[model samples]
Target: MSEGAFKKYGKRTLVYLFLILMSIISVFPLYWCFISSCNNTQQILGGRMVPSTHLIENLKNLFAQQDVLNAFKNSVINTVLVLVLSLAICSIAGYGFEIFHDKGKDAVMAVIMMSMMVPFVAILVPLFQMFTKMGFVNKYIGYILPSLSTPFLIMLFRNNARTFPKEVLEAARVDGLSEFGIFVRMFVPMMRPTFAAAATITFMNTWNAYLWPKVVLQTPDSITMPMLVANLLSGYVVDYGVVMAGVTICTLPTVIVFFILQKSFTEAVAGAVK
Candidate 1:
């Protein structure tokens, strides 16, 4: 090979090596979590990465606590409800903003984007008071309602909707199809990739939600997985094995969902970017 070609190949090889190293570093924590979950109490406390014989014991302990199952169920319901409602509302609003243009609507979209700039912590006190006034504290609705209209999801949908062919929309209009009919029949099917991406992200966020749920949900029965994990970690003795087992259980659903939707999710993002 020529010297210049050899030099370029060498630089590419170095870049590949650097990326591989970074990937390993990024994935190490998850690997450790899994290993620690399967380890014995001694191994976990000792900070060893290898698995131990206490896997069965940890699993048994995790299942023996009845509250864990209840918490899991509550979390699943809350996550699913939040994902469904949030996606539906955000997607529709996004599509509307994109397809039905008006100066007033543009101002409204600007306001929605500005709302994303406000930190949740800044609004928590007011939100808590409002929920309390409405007697929504400790209710599933309290957890799901505030999140049902995410600005990010709306933005995502809007961007994806831009990819929809204007010709198709115009043709539908010529066919005497109403705006709503065009959106439902043509735009919705074309945006499956975007929906899949949105679903994956929204589901994971809702599933792993900690702060809001912790504040709103007062009872054990109403608590979600992250809240339960926080409570587990806060116990006086802090049994690492038990905590690992709970973490494993709590992480499984999101991981499974990601694996299932990963292809479509990637395609969705790519399509949106295009």
Candidate 2:
């Protein structure tokens, strides 16, 4: 090879090596958590990063706790509900903003964007008071209702919809399709990738949600995974093994969902760019 070509190849090889190292470093924590979850209390305390023979024991202990199962079920339900509701609502709103633009709609979009800038913590007190007054505390509706209209998700959908071909919608219109019909039949199928990306993100957010669930869900049965995990850690003597198990349980669903939808997630971003 020529000297210039050799030098360019060498630079690219070095960059690839650096990226591989960075990726390993980023994933090491998750690997360690998995290992720790399989370890016994003694192994964990000894700082062992390898799997121990205590995996069965840890599983037994986790399942022995009655509340753990209930918490797991509640978390699953909440996560699924939130994912479905948020995705549907956000996608529809996003499509509307992009496909049916008007002066009023533009103004509404601006307001939604501005709402995203408001710190969630800033509204917590008022939201709590409102929920309390409305008798929504300790209810599933309290948990789900507040998150149904996420501004960030709406923005994500709207931004993605910008890349959708206007001609496609026009053709649907020419074919005597109503706006809702076009959205349901044509737009949704075409936007699968974007929807997958949005679903993965929203599902993760809802699954890992802690503060809101903790505040709103007063009853043990209604508490989501993160809230349950927090409560487990709140005990005076924290059981690291049990806590790690809880963390794994709480994380597995989102991880599985992400892996399942990863192709769509990438395609969605690619479609948006196109």
Candidate 3:
């Protein structure tokens, strides 16, 4: 073979080898968790990696808890609500900031971005006090409100929106559509990939939210899935098998959503603004 051809083959081979190694590293934890979830705490403590005969028993114990299924449902509801509300708010904010342009909006966006640097824990005390005064303690709304439009997501949408074609928007206005109509009818359809990307991220963030939910939700009836998983180990003797099963179950929805939006994610994240 020619030297150039051999060099090309060697580079491609190295890239593939690196990718395979990274894939294994990323997936090994989930694989181990699945294996561990199928065994009892004693077997897990013994460092077993292979699947055992206790899978059904582990699942039974996880679901037999009264709060498990309810928390799962609450998680679904909160995730869906956050997904819908966050997409609407962030998409509009992004489009307006990028397409419309204003000094005041720019200043406001800067402030919002700066706020992200402050740790959520720093604001938890004030937020809890405000929620208590407003009677949002132990409420689903409390779980869904704090993250309605995250700064990182807003910036993501804005950057993506900047790539949107200006000519089409002007043409829509020439056709006598109002500003809101132009946004809803013209911009939204063209930004389907962006919306899909936003929905996937917002849903995952909401589904996996734990610290805030645990802090504000004082009652079992309103607790979320992550909170429930955490509560599993509150007793003197922790059950590793049940906790791993709960973790596996908690991981499925995010995985499913990512798979469903995989193509959209790639397409939306690609390209840059002119």
Candidate 4:
């Protein structure tokens, strides 16, 4: 090979090596968790790296010792509701902010974005008191209410919306399509990647949420997966295997969602900056 070609190939090889190293670093904790879940407590304490045959045994212990099914059900319900509702509300808000021309819209968006700077903890106590008065404590509504819309998500959609084809909107309008119809039929399909990105972010955030849910969900029956895992660690005698099992279960859904939407998520995030 020519010297320049060899140099180019050498750089590509170095880049691949760097990426592989980073991938292993990123995935090692998940690998450890999965493997530990499949081993006995003794094996885990011994720093076992390989999978063992005790996975079913650990899972059975996990279910027997904890309300795995109930927690799983609650988490699924809360995550699904939050994901669906948040996406609908935020996407529409985003679409409107970008698609509809209004002199005051930018000011409204700036105010919304400013809210992101306020720590959630600042409102936690007040929100709890208000929810208590409203009788939403320990309810799914309490779980779903706080996350129904976020400024970052709205901004995500708005940025992507700016890239949407105005020509299509004009054509649809000329054909007698209403604004809602244009958004529903045309904007949604065109912005699928952004929606996928938003969905993945929302699902992951809602699923793995611990603090707000822990505070609002006062009843034992309303516990979520993160709460369940926290319970495992809270006991005086923590079982390594069972704890790992609980963590694996808790991590599974987000991992699945990310892998499924990873391509679109990447595309949408990259496009947002442009």
Best by lDDT: 4
Tens-digit lDDT string for candidate 4 (75-167): 999999998999999999999999884879988998998998999999999999999999999999998998998988888899889988889
RMSD of 2: 2.9
Is 2 or 4 the stronger prediction by lDDT?
Answer: 4
Give candidate 1's whole-model lDDT.
Answer: 0.85
Taking the candidates one at a time, how many backbone clashes does each contain?
0, 0, 0, 0
Native RMSD of candidate 3 (Å): 3.0
- For TM-score, candidate 1 versus 3, the one ahead is 1
Candidate 1 lDDT tens digits, 167-202: 999999999999889988998899887888888878
Whole-model lDDT per candidate: 0.85, 0.82, 0.84, 0.91
The weakest ten consecutive residues by lDDT in model 3 span: 265-274
Please state the error at residue 4 of candidate 3 in Å: 12
TM-score of candidate 4 versus the correct structure, residues matched by position: 0.92
TM-score to true structure, per model: 0.90, 0.87, 0.88, 0.92
lDDT of 4: 0.91
State the lDDT of candidate 2 residue by residue for 173-228, as single tens digits: 99999999999999899988788787777777788888888888998788887887
Off by over 4 Å in 1: 1-13, 263-274
lDDT of 4 at 115: 97
Which has the higher lDDT value, candidate number 1 or candidate number 4? 4
